[model samples]
Target: MIGRRLLVAAAAAGAGWVARAAWGTVPALGASRSAIRPYAAGSPRYRDNRFHNSEPSSSLPSGSQSGLAKAFLTRGATGRPRRAIPLAAPLAPTAAGELAVTWLGHATALIEIDGRRVLTDPVWSDRVSPSAVLGPARMHPMPMALEDLPTIDAVVVSHDHYDHLDQSTVVRLARTQSTIFVVPVGVGAHLRRWGVPADRVVELDWDESTEVAGLTLTCTEARHFSGRGLARDTTLWASWVIAGPRRTVFFGGDSGYTTRFADIGRRYGPFDVTLLPVGAYDERWPDIHMNPEEAVRVHLDVDGGLLIPIHWATFNLAFHPWDEPITRLLDAAADAGVTMSVPMVGQRIDGVRPPEQKPWWQGLA
Candidate 1:
C-alpha cells in the first residue's frame, strides 16, 4: 500500500510540473477548460492626442447571428467545385524593387515595399487551433521554413486569432530576428507574456500612426472581432498602412465591411498595392471574413492601386472549398476592373510588376 501511494504521489507531482511548463510555453500544447478571457475590441478614445482609439469592449458581444446576417444580404460561398491544388514554392523576390509580395500561404505574407521588408500575419504552424493535435490542419506544407525567411525589418500582426497571431510563430520570429513587432492594442500583453521585450513591441490603436525606421505605420480600422480561447474581444484589431517615400501600401488584416476603408483612403489614398483578406468567409460568419466581392469593395474603398488576395489556401478555416475564395475574387475583380496579383505560397509577386500570368490555383479547381 505504501509503495502504491508513493507511486501515485510521484505521478501527481510530475503532472503538475508538466502543466506548469505548458503554461509557460505558448502555442498551448493542451486545451484549457476555461474559455479565453476577453480584451478590448476597439475604442473611440485617443491617447497623447495622436489618433482616435476604438477598442473591442466587452460591452458588445458577437455570435452566430453576426455572420448569418451578413450572408443573408449577399450570397454565401456557392460557385464551383474544388480541385486538388498543390502549392508552388520559393517565389524568389529581388532585393531591388518598389514592392515584392510573397504569399507564404494563408494570410502570411512577406512584403518588401518601397525598400522596407515587412511580414504580415505570419502563421507557420501546422494547425490554427489551441492544441497541436487538433483543429484546422494545414492543407499543404509551408513553402519555406520560417528559418529560411530573409531578414525582416518588421512583423505586422492583424489580430490575436490562433491563425493570425500564432504563438509558436511568434516565438520563432523572436528567436530568429529582433524585428519591430507592430501589433494592435492589447496584443502587447500576449507578446509580453511570451517574453518579447516591451520596446520591441509597438502597440497601436485604430487610426494611430507611428514611425519606425523612417517608415510610417498607421493602424487603420478593420471590421472584425478577436479571441484566442474562450475569451472574446479584449484586444483591438486593425488593418495597416505602410507609407514609404516612393509609394504606399495597405495591409488589411481581417475585417467585414465598414466605412473605415473610405476613411483610410481619404487620409491615405491611391495606395500602390493593397494586401487584403479574401477567404475564410461563410454565411454563418460573413461579417468577420470578407468574401472576395466584399474584399474587392474594400479594396476600392481604400483607393488601392493594385490588390493582392490573401487569407485563403493553406488552411481550411471555413467550410467553403479551398479554391472558392480565389475564384470569386477573380470574377469580382474582373467585373470591377480592379487589377490583382495572385501568387502561390512562397512565390514573390512583384505587386508593381505584372504578375507571372498563371492560374496556378486553377490546378486546384
Candidate 2:
C-alpha cells in the first residue's frame, strides 16, 4: 500500500509541474503569427509573410552554432558581478524638464523631452522568458517601484523580444496607467491580447510618425529580428526619433552596425542626446547586437551630442564579464571624443547640464 501511495504522489507532482509551465506560457507568449500578420502585411518591410530588415542580417554567423554551444558550457559566472550593484534613487522632478533621462536598467528608460515624459521599453519583471521560472533573471532589484513612476505621456516599445516587451509589465501598466503604447507595426496585437485597450495602442511602420503630448515619435530602421516563439520575424523592430519643439532625442533600441543611422541622422540630425544599447553583444552574432566600439560609431553616425548607454548592468544576457561592456564603451567614447554620462540605475541625467561620469561599476565588478 505504501508503494502504491508513492506512485500516486509522483503522478500528482508531474501533473502540477505541467500545469505551472502552461500557466506561464499561454499568456506570456502573446499573439501568434496569424494574429500579427494581418497588421504587419501593410508595411513595406513585410514581404512573403515576414518582415525583412533594410539590409540582410543574420542572427548567428555561419557554422558558429557549435562554437557558441561550447562557449556557453564553459562560460561559468563571468556575466555576474562580484558584489551588489549600486542603485540610485530616481529624481523626483516637479515637472518634466527640457531634456533628461532616467535609466531604469537594461533597455528600460524614462525620457523627459520638452516638458513631456516618455517611457521606453519598460520591463519590470524578474525574469524575461515565456516560462516564468526560466530565462535571464534580474541581477539587481528595480531601483524604484513601478507604481511610484510619475505620470507617463506614452510608453514606446522597441520590439517584441522578451527582454524588451514583457507581458507582465505590459499588463500591469495597462491596468495602472493611462499612458498610450507606441510600438512598431503588428506589436499592437500583443498589447491587445494582454487586455490593453485598442485605442490606447498606436502602431507605426518605419518612417511613419505619430504625435503624442506635443512630441513627434518617428519609427526608424534598425538591423534586428523579432519573435516570441517558433515563428520568427512576424513583427517588425525599429529605433525611434523623439522630437520636440526645441530638442530631439534618438533611441537606438537594439541594432547592429548599420549605415542606416546616417540616413536617420540626415533626416533628424543633431539630436540633443541619444540612448543606445551597449551590451549582450557577441562575435558570433555581430549582425544583430553591436559591440561597445560599434556603439560609439553609431553615436557619431546619428550625430548625437550627449550619449547615455543602456542594455547593460541589469541582466546577464552575454558571456563577457559583468562590467566589460561599460569599460570598453568608456575607452571607445574617450577615443572618439564623445561626451557621455554613465548613470547608476535610476539616476537621472540632465542633457542641458550633464554631470561628469562616475565609475560606479568599478569596485562591484
Candidate 3:
C-alpha cells in the first residue's frame, strides 16, 4: 500500500512537469544565429498576387496549377473524414550520434545533418489548431523535452500550417537558442509575430539557395497552400533541399505529386536520404497531398538511396485510420522494391550507416 502511494505521487509529479513544458514556459533550444535571412516585404514571393489576393477559394500559382480547376482545388478537399490523434508527450529529446534524427511525432523532425543540428516543422503542442482550446490533442507524450534538444544550427519551417508552424514552439526556440530560422517566404511574418529575431530569420523562394552554417539550404518547390487564419496564399508553401558535405537530404515539407520532384532530382538528385510525406491524403483532393503510392513514386523519382516516411503517425489532420498511412506506404514500397527507413518517434537513423529500419508500427492499434 505504501509503495503504491509513492508510485502514484511520482506519476503526478511527472505529469505536472510535462504540463508546464506544454504550456510553453521553457526554452527548447540554445544556439547562436549565424545564418539569418534578409527579405523585403515587397518581394515577389510576398507580393499581393491574384491567386492569393483574389477570392478565398483559389489555389496559389504554380507550374501545373492553372485555370478554373486550380481555383476549385483551393477551396477545400472532398470527403473530409474525421481523424483521431495520439496523446503525445510535449518534451522529446535529441539522441546521441554523428547524424541523428528524432521524430517528435507528426511532420516535426529534429535532424542533425553534417554535424549541424536542424529542426524541421517542430510542433510540440497537444493539438494542431489555431485556437488551442479546440483541436486534436496528442495521444502520446512527446518522446523528449524541447529544452533537452542540443544546440541547433537552424530551424527549417516548411509552411504556415498550424501543424508545422506552431507559434508557441517558435517563441520557445527563439528564447532558448539564437537559432537561425529558415522558412519559405512570408512565413517570416509569423515568426516575427512570435518574437523571433528578424536577423535570425531567413525566408527564400522556390529554387533559391542560401547557406546556413556551412550547409547549403535550397528552398525547393511544393504543391500546397499556406494560411494560419482564412488568409491563404499570403505565405508560400515549399519543400527543401538540405545539402551537407557528406550527404544531401530532401525534405518533402508537404505537397501533392508534381513534376518538380523530377526537377529537384536533376538539380539535387540522388539524395542519400529523402524524408517524404506519405499520409493525410484523399482522392477528393489529390492535387494537394500525395497518397502512399505517390510518395513511393517520388522516392524513386528523387533517386534517394534510402527513403524515410514522415508526415504520418504523428497527427491525424485528415480522416483515415491512424495506421492507414504506414500500412499503405509499406505495401506500396514493397511492390515498388524501394528501400525505406521507418523510425519510431525519437529514434535516430544515421545517414552514413542508418540502422536497418523495421516496420515498428506493425502492432500499433
By TM-score, how accurate is candidate 2? 0.96
Estimate the TM-score for candidate 3: 0.77
Residues 183-235 of candidate 2: C-alpha lDDT, one tens digit per residue? 99999999999899999999999999999999999999999999998888999
1 against 3, candidate with superior lDDT: 1
Report lDDT per candidate.
0.75, 0.92, 0.72
Best by TM-score: 2
* Positional deviation of residue 170's Cα in model 3 after best superposition, in angstroms: 0.1
Q: Which ten residues in a row have the lowest lDDT in candidate 2?
A: 18-27
The positional error of residue 66 in candidate 2, measured at the CA in angstroms, is 6.2
- Misplaced by over 4 Å in model 3 are 1-98
Worst 10 residues of 1 by lDDT: 30-39
Q: Candidate 1 on 1-365: residue-level lDDT in tens? A: 99999999999999876675455334442122121122233345323321222433221235655665464445443322355555667754446357778888778988877777888998988888766655667877898989988878889999888889888888889999979899887777787677788789988877788887667899888877776665555566789999888888899988876766888999988898898898877665555678899999999988988899988877765667668888889999999999998887778787777666688877554
